[model samples]
Target chain A: MASLHSAVLDLRRLELMANGDSTIHRLDARAKVLVTLVFIICVVSYTRYELAALFPFFIFPVVMVSLTGIPPLFIIGKLALLCPFVLAMGLFNPVFDREILVQLGTLGISGGWISFASILTRSILTVGTAFILVGTTGFTAVCRALERLGMPQVFAVQLLFLYRYIFVLTEESGRASRARELRSCGKKGLGIRSFGSMTGHLLLRTWQRAERVHMAMLARGFSGEFRTHHVSRFGWAEITFITVWSGLLIFMRIFNIPHLLGALLAGSIS
Target chain B: MSHHIVQVKGLRHIYPDGTIALQEVSFLIHHGESVAIIGANGAGKSTLLQHLNGYLTPTAGDINIGDFPLTRATLPDIRRTVGMVFQDPDDQLFMPTVFDDVAFGPLNLGLSGSILEQRVEECLSRVGAAHLRDKPPYHLSGGEKKRVAIATVLAMSPDILVMDEPTSGLDPHARRQLLALLKDFSHTKIFTSHDLDMVFELCERTIILHEGLVKADGPTREIFNNADLLAECCLEKPFSMQNCAACGRPKTGL
Candidate 1:
């Protein structure tokens, strides 16, 4: 119960960062969304053994965090929450293939180890850029941007509703859990034995709540469509923001800056 | 003929699971009059409110809002006539910011550009929530959320306003402020609440529902003054009325 309460609060804190007044935060949401999408695409498009190339992608999130005045700890904390999934995804890579790729000092680095590093680095970069996008632009603006970018109205509305109700659902579950805890008196409550019934109860409650919410929407003239009043224009600043970010991302993808710098430094010293 | 702004005739709502939620419930609300529906939990208060705007279809009954009958085709117009403020403001204020939530109904009605903005502003100012226009609904305090929820409905410019437990979870100061705001509105108002004090202040007529039936209906003063009837319906008289009776003072004007 305590963790659930704090989790809800932490989510709110992360979203509150978008309220800051800064250059990055003030940028058009559409531009931020498009740039973040492009960044993720470029980072993930790298080859399996392209660990060094993926390092440069970290600049996007770092610059966004600094420019938007969002706390680095907050972004990293969110990243940590997601790290387990990414780690699980690449955990088998180190055992699948054992082709020796190169020699670093006395250790022989295998292709599997290189690819594993690449996957982890890529996951961090992509996820970090996404975190920065949401932190700087806020979820509402992101939905509006998606709607304006020709995504279906229903999908955009679903995203908005899902984001809005997550808190409500969390609080409901937290309260229910608290009630169970109060009655269970330090016994093994909320265990596997009770999990099924608890989930079923939660589902029923959420369904009823959804019905009430739908009725409320219908009462106010909602006729099967979710209409938004946010009017986003693709002006010069938005265009420039998208173009500069995309151009840089494509440049970084095409040319391996880390490899080039390493070779240049080696040649210069010799 | 008198203007019956809202008329519910023999309204019977049966749940899908064979539960009779509302049985033979009938009522008429005149224009510009405030009515309160008071009942314990599961008294079909919410089910009845849902029927008013055509959200829930009656199993066997009729609801006429203004000139439009409650049907599939007239749902839009009926909803436009009856703006509902939900019990939990969070459920109503689903939009990201207060302004958007306020503007939702108007936008759905196809009012756009400056006209939509003007309506939102007017409603927000009317509810004293203009300063909360840009704040997200989640960021608002409970009282502010309730006010914004009212503003969201008021922005549609409905002729009749129906609310469910408008003062359910408010502090005394917030409750008093809400009562004052509701009192200032000139539209036809219908609400369901457990707050008898609010009913005394804001509603001229009160309807008590018990076990899916209208146990009593009359002027608010007469109904609250009847302790026996209230007790039968599992309701206590308003504290003010009880105090008056204890002091042996005459019932004064509200």
Candidate 2:
């Protein structure tokens, strides 16, 4: 229960970070959103053997984190929580494919190892770019950007509502858990027997709450759609931001900057 | 004759599972009158409030708000006419920022640009929440959230305001502030609350509900002064009345 409470608090802290007036935060949400999308597409478009090429892609998220004053450790910590799933997805690769692809001094590297590394890199870059997007633009602004970019209004509203109610749901469940703990004494009273009923009660409460919310929405003249004051205009700065970032992303995608830099360094050393 | 801004007749609501939430409830609220509905839990105050905005179609009765009948065709006008402030501020303030939430209703009415911004700003300032314009609803304090919730409804310029448990879960200071704010609103107000003191302070009339029925309804003073009726409805006397009784002062009629 305590950990759940802190997790919600951490989410709130991340949102508060978006309220800062840093350069990255000041960039229009449309710009940040478009750039992040381009960055992700470029990162994921890399071939399996192109691990070195993915390293320079890290610059987008790193620069975002630094410029926005979002803590590197916090973003890394969030990524760490998701690492197990990414690791699991690629863990069996080395055993499945044993074809040697390259030699590293005295050791042979297989295609499986290279692909596995590529998967990990892709996950990090994509997830990191997503975090930077949210950290810099905030969730609401991102939703507005999505709507402006021609995403369906219903989807944008659904995303906003989901984010809004997640806290309410978490708090309700936390209170329920606390009540259970207080009465259970030694945790003996709460087992699978009670868990089903507890979850059932939670669902019932959520349904009733949702109904009330719908009533509130109806009272406010919410017909079939949601209306907001968020009118995002694509100004020159936003266009410039998108143009510069997309061009850079395309250039990075076409030519492997890490491989080129490595070759140049190797040549200069020789 | 005083015009009835809201009229509900033979109102009954049955849940899909067959639980009778409300039955045979009827009431008339006149223009510019402030009324408070008091009841125990499950007394169907919330169900009755939902009917006013045509959110919950009464299983057996009719509701008329101003000239609009509570029906599918008139739902939009009914909603616009009767602004509802929900018990939970979280549910009401669904938008990301205070400004957006306040502007939601007005924007739906097709107000745009400076006019929309001005309406939102006016409501926020009316509730003393203009400072929180840019803040997300989740970031607000409980009292601030309540104020913003009221602003969200007020921006619509409704003829009648319905609030469910407006003062629930609020601290004494917040409750006092809310009471002060509610006092300033000129709209025909209908509120459901367990706060008898607030009822005594703000409402001129009171309706008590029990077992899904209109158990009693009258002037607030008369309702609160009737100790026997209060006991029957599972309600306590307002704190001030109890304090007056404690001091051996005879209860005086207002």
Candidate 3:
């Protein structure tokens, strides 16, 4: 519960951070979206046991975080919450592929461990890029960007509604948590039964709210068509932003930068 | 035709679960008039209001906006003519920012470019919310959200304004400002609220709905004055109309 509470608060900060007037925020959302997509694709395409090459990809999110002036701790905290899901997927890798792949002075590391570490690294890098995308360009702007970039209008509308109502969901959940705390005789813990019923009630309430919002949209001349009126256009800056970022991302994808740099340092020392 | 003339005759609405929300509810509201529909909980105020814009099709009878009846074909046109402010502003302001929400209706009507920008700005300024344009709805106060929600509707330039409990969740000052804004709109205004005081002050006519029925419909003053009728509908007079709590006599205006 505490983790979920902090998660909501931190995620809300992403929306606030998106409103910042930094260079990253000023870039068109479509540009950021495409850059982040290219970054993710690069990160995800690495071989299962490849690890060192993924290290350079961390620069993308780091640069965005610094340029946007969004606190690194916030994004790290958000990423840490999802790390366990990646952990579950990678934990079994070490058990299945146990062949020794690398040797230190006195210790050996197996292929499974390397693959597991690689999986974890790729997941974090890809997910971190997405977080940066949303942190710099808001969810709505991203939806608009997706729509303008040839995504089906219906899907973009769905994403918009989902992003818009997440606040309402958190608020309703917060209120429900407060009410439960108030009645629990100074006990802050939520019981399993209460959690069960609370989740059911929240679902029902969210469903009803969705219906009401749909009616409100219908009342305001909505005829199943969502029109994007954001005046932000694709221009030279956006073109440059995408070209530079995608070029860098694809360059890093093709060449193992850390490996090449390490070899250069080793040869210079020789 | 100037804006909107709402005429409902024997309108009935039944939920899928066999709950008859409205039964034979009828009213005629001319353009440029302010009317209030006040009732207790479960009295069908919301169901009746939903019919005005074709949000919910009436189980029986008809609703006419200007010259056309509320039908599937006319739903779009009537929705354009009648703007609805929902009970919860959060439900209406679903856009990412106040500006987007205000522009949602006008953009749907195909008014883009500078005309759309001007429409959005005009509506936001009308609601005294131009300063809040770039802010997201989640950041707004209750009153600001309400103002922006109304601005969303006003951007459409509807002839008839229909609101469901417009002032329900507002503070006193917010309520006061909303009433002042409502008074400024020259087109037809319709509201369903438990705030009888607002009805007495803003609306000239009041309709009392009781158990899916129009218990009474007449001048606002007369309806409030009828203590017997008010009691039958399980309602009380507005605080402004009730005798002074500390004093022995009715208020000065009465």
Q: Which candidate is the best by lDDT?
A: 3
Off by over 4 Å in 1: A16-28, A96-98, B1-4, B111-118, B243-254
Worst 10 residues of 3 chain A by lDDT: A1-10
Superposed Cα deviation of residue A171, candidate 3 (Å)? 2.9
Please identify model 3 stretches exceeding 4 Å from their true place: A1-6, A26-28, A95-97, A186-190, A194-196, B1-3
lDDT tens readout by residue for model 2, B143-165: 99999999989999988999999
TM-score for predicted model 2 compared with the true structure:
0.89
lDDT of 3 by residue, A183-250 (tens): 99787566777899899999899888888888888877777667766467778988998898899989
- Give lDDT for model 3: 0.86
Tell me the TM-score of each prediction against the true structure.
0.90, 0.89, 0.92
DockQ of each: 0.63, 0.62, 0.64
Angstrom error of the Cα, residue B120, model 2: value is: 3.2
Please provide, for model 3 over B1-254, each residue's C-alpha lDDT reduced to its tens digit, 9 standing for 90 to 100: 53378899999899999999997898889988899999889999988887788878788998889989888898888888898989888788876678878988888888888999999999999999999988878789999999999999989888889999988989999999999999888989999999999998899999999999999999999999999999989999999998889976888967
- For model 2, report DockQ: 0.62
The 10-residue segment of model 1 chain B with minimum total lDDT is B245-254
Report the C-alpha lDDT of model 2 over A1-270, residue by residue, as the tens digit: 787787777776776677678766777788888888889888888787778888877778887777788999998988887789988999999989899998999899999999999999899889978877887777878887888789998899889778867776787789888888889997668577889999999888877777667777778887666554545466887888888878988998998887888899999999
TM-score of the A-chain for all models: 0.90, 0.88, 0.88
